[model samples]
Target: MTIDLPEYPFPQPTALEPPAEWAELRAKCPVAEVRLASGDQALVLTRYQDVRQVLSDPRFSRLLNADDAARVTANESGGVFGSEQAERTPVGEGHQRWRRLVGRYFTAKRMAAMQPRIQAMAEQLLDEMVAGGAPADLVSAYGFPLPVWVICDLLGVPDSDRVKFAYWSDHMLSLTRYRQDEINAAQLEFGEYIWAHIDAKRAEPGDDLISDLIVVADAEDGQLSQMELIGTAQGLLVAGHETTANMIGKMTAMLLADRDRWEQLLAEPALVRSAVEEALRFDANPGFGMPRYLTEEIEVSGTKLPPGTTVISSMAAANRDEEAFDNAGDMDLRRTPNPHLAFGAGPHSCIGQALARTELQTALNVLLNRLPGLRLDGSPEELPRREGLIIGGLERLMVRW
Candidate 1:
């Protein structure tokens, strides 16, 4: 029996809460087949436990679904569906080694050490926002700039070059605005830019992530090539910039959606961490987490799936699953064991999670502490939403103190 699932990222009235359809799906049809705008059919796992299992299972491979694998082809020669060549995956010791080489850079200790710098950057952004006066678009002015600066700081990219990186990063992550042609061009430009910059950095290394990468590349040779460097830079720029930055805007919007919640956080400053956690859970960034492909036959909640089946897991919906927590729909500041998949799960989970947490907490804390009178200038629903299916965030956040 075929069950119709709503398109991924069902049109949200606002960025704060996910589409209400997700709730219905969770209750009645936890695992259902969804027809995507790309004219492809895929299974969507909505329940928290089911989503978690799919994410944590190693058999569910991401490389397989790197392309739109659900599109069925009429030609029998091409099999039932049309999927692009799977991206290469590092195996065994190579994968572990690669993880360690890059993973150490984003450890809790490293992020803690960078706290002062992150706080200072947040302070500087707030200072500029305050100087600009009231009724400012906090998103473009503060939300976007903070993470851009933070990531570039780590990469050793100069402030003057941030706009260029931002443009490229925006296109790379954009789901709706830029077309495939524009995305390809932006990607090409970004690669050329990063490659040139890496050469410059190679000539004169510095005390930064890019320089560190250069040093390792020099020693390892084949392990870190010029192309690899370019790809890494792109990943760092795109991934590092979009999600956490959007989280800041979305989280703030959620926190202040209720004036009482805003005031409560203000009254008890200690709740800042709690408030951040709740915001992360409440405004979990991706409506549906990254896509995965099933490498082996699997049964999720009794829905049997054959191998090579594409699956889309909704972390946002999973976070709101009734069985997951008490008052799952509401944001509880002190909700213990808030096991939201905002950062995802397993080996493919976010590598920059520690840094992201630091940036979110620091940015939110600065906002509440300094701008105690800060409030939404208009209804969040009326505020512009991002034009993308992969990620959802406010296009602009107008605020006044």
Candidate 2:
């Protein structure tokens, strides 16, 4: 049975709800062609197993040719984040070296040690929320700032410079309000800012990620060049902050909207981890899974995808595949052995998964403990979802206790 996939202006999915049409597409054709915003044909992998295999399989390369990459973005120019150049970086040796250099700071052990600090930051933010009274915008009061603060502290970025960093990061990740000139300018500004920070670290080395990167660079016989260092730092700054912040806001809003779930979490705090996993599964905006171009003709899930075809693995769709989970649409905090790809799989899997989990777990625990009667201040339907672009989240979430 052929199904007509919805066109652009499609309703953005939320942490609390999947797009209404997802189930239909999953049932009919798990692997189908999607017309991207750029009006180019890109393969969309909707099934859990198919998406996972595509994400992990090296046959499908993330490196896109200049022409294909440009076509992927509606702007006809390059993307806001310099994704074109990012993908061009050699995925074998160069990528591994880069990942190794930064891995020291993002290790699971180090993130585990950061739980107390993250919890402290969460409490401080929640305290201010209570002081601000009901009808407070959680995004501004807590969501936006918590992850930025934590990541900045971890990377040794000065608190005062966070505002500037935040601006550049937003433009870099934003799909709307971006032009070629703006994207280029932001890249240059961010590069300069990171270089300056690296210089300062060189003068007085501190116990931070930047300082550690410098040490590794010097020891590796200068394997990491100046541009690479700055680029790596900038990438961490954005990923460490934006994605986690969105998850925090969306998760909080979802819990508050469902009083039973909120009470369930409060009564049994041990469910926080499972709750976070469910939140990741339900939050449908990670800017679309990492895009890959077929290097050679390959068949995925019985569909013939020719060489040069762009493939997009939808984490939102995969998480909700009925074949993967029973009653996939329902939010079950008790879901054991949950195998969701909220974090992409394989070599490109999120390097900071541990840190992100720590942040989410900490935020939920503190919010539930402090705001037992927490509830949404406005109707859930009224909160507009950020659409057309990637990274699904609410524009603003107001809450009252």
Candidate 3:
């Protein structure tokens, strides 16, 4: 059952709408070929089970720098996907060890403890947004800054340098947005800044993720090499800030896009937790799905994939599979026992998920409590999405209260 390979990330009619091809592909060709921005071809998995299987399987690796692996973007550097830092990132046992060491800080309990601080930050940002007046772009005013502030605090990064951090992060994760030279320059500058920051932390440690990791590294006597340490910081800074920031805006937009959803939340505040999870599950534009380079032959959805093949798991598509969820297309605020692959799956699942969840829940709570009248200032369908980035998100969430 072979079909023409459509461009990967099939086009969407609107910012909030899912691509029509997601359903078609999932039903007809669960395992199908697609072309990447780099003009390389790869197979995309659209079924729920197959997507999760490939992600959790150890045979499918994140080592996308293999000579034969398909480049993810048009840029020669491969953006973050094929970057030197990504190549150096530990895999297998070494990767698990790195996760164990850093996972301690992101546990549910720790995120729960950090909730108050996150709430305070959200409130302050909301206050400033309110003071500035309505018809505001929530993406810039509220969504962007909140997560950056949280990540800065977590990494002990100076808040004053957030502008620079944002710039570096953009180039690092960009798919078609930045040129190769610009990406290289940004990486160099970021590396130098992180190294200097590490030196400063070594001289004077603080109660932050990086400082704590440094102490452990020092105690373990180079258990984590300097490169690993720097990569850890850079990875956390980018992942922590970008995904959650986009999500905050998207979640709010999803709720307000339907006034009924907002009214339901206002009526039943207990649904906030489940609502956040649902928003994650319901997000249609979550950017490029996870890419894994196969080290061994594998068959997915009856399609045989050979070694040295690059396969993309379209979690967004899987989330909407009717075979996976009841009435999968509808956004049910009360959808309980919801499990979605928004953070990915298996060993490589997002380490900062707890923190992200906390921030989102807190943001929603604060928005509901303070701006009970919050409503979309424009049509959700007309909203613009951020272009030329690996991650997908709204460009601006126009709202007024």
Clash pairs detected, candidate 1: none
lDDT (C-alpha) at residue 108 in model 2: 78
List, residue by residue over 258-290, the lDDT tens digit for candidate 2.
Answer: 778888998899999999998777654445555
Show model 1 residue runs off by greater than 4 Å: 1-5, 64-93
lDDT of 3 by residue, 199-299 (tens): 99999999898998888777756668777888788777777777788888888999999999999999999999999989988988888887888989988
- Among these predictions, the greatest lDDT belongs to 3
Looking at model 2, report the run of 10 residues with the lowest lDDT sum.
73-82
- Among all windows of 10 consecutive residues in model 1, the one with the lowest summed lDDT is 74-83
Reference-based TM-score of each model: 0.90, 0.90, 0.94
RMSD of 3: 3.7
Count: clashes, candidate 3: 0
When sorted by TM-score, best at the front, the candidate numbers are: 3, 1, 2
Identify the leading candidate in terms of TM-score. 3
User: lDDT at 177 for candidate 2?
Assistant: 51
| Per-model lDDT | 0.71, 0.71, 0.81
